[model samples]
Target: MKNLVFALFLLPTATVGSAGLAFGEDSRQLATLPPPAQEALREEMRDNLVALNEVLSLMVAGKVKEAGEVAEAKLGVSAMGKHRSKPMDARPGPHMPPAMHGIGMDGHKAASEFAAVAKTGDRDKALALLPNLTSACVACHFSYRIR
Candidate 1:
């Protein structure tokens, strides 16, 4: 009976741990770039997505300090050069709207928050924060169409 009770108690922790690892895997997969870029801007967007996934996976794995470092590095990479204003001129058409920059920025913010929560070593807090981090992806996708 004691063994059965202990097994039951361990189930939820095991499930949550597995889920966290699964999320990390999924985030890493999302970071991959498509083969061959015809235009510079398209390549930039693909690279940014890859960078975002790197930071997100680190957050899910409870590596906040490393995630922050990755985030800063990604920001620097993404911020390189001026964004072209015209859609036809932009590599990946249609161009992202000026207002939609918030979507990408918000995703980074959510990733940062998730990493901070995970660093506390509280599984409950990390789990609770996970959905917010994912929602940023959905929000960005809704506002920006990727080719």
Candidate 2:
């Protein structure tokens, strides 16, 4: 199951580039945003990637509670509050298509769920939840892009 989970996580990365090439000229829908919102969204995405790495590293180091803390702080629904201070038009959520926004919300929820489970120090259960946390990212990236 661990191997299966690892493979599932890698599958998207393994296929993304080839899928794009084979399909010709990225067919993903373009999400138009105000320049400020776009920049903010991109920065948030970069931070998310960093957080993802940190969570994985912490998990591997057997610091499950630390990993959970990072997940809640960085990827959970609470992280969404950062955009509240931005102008409505300058917030990514307001600009995103409903489906795209739903995926994004689902990803955050997944992270929150993973964090809760991780805090219990159940390594197997936490590992099982990995795909739920990551598949939303894979789906959203495959389906939409900023332009």
- Return the TM-score for each candidate structure: 0.42, 0.84
Query: Candidate 2: which pairs clash?
Result: none
Give the alpha carbon lDDT tens digit for every residue of 1-147 in model 1.
222234345657656877857553432212222223225546665776787688668767877666656654554323433344534444332344544454545555665666565556556666666555445455544334434
Error of model 2, residue 69, in angstroms:
1.1
**Candidate 1 wrongly placed segments (more than 4 Å):** 1-95
Query: Model 2 — TM-score against the truth?
Result: 0.84
Model number with the top TM-score: 2
Predicted candidate 2 versus true structure: per-residue lDDT over 1-147, tens digit per residue: 233345456766767657747655767799998999998898999999999999999999999888888998999877877888989877888899998898888788889999999989888888888667677777788678997
Model 1: how far residue 120 lies from native, Å: 1.5
**Cα displacement (Å) at residue 48, model 1:** 7.0
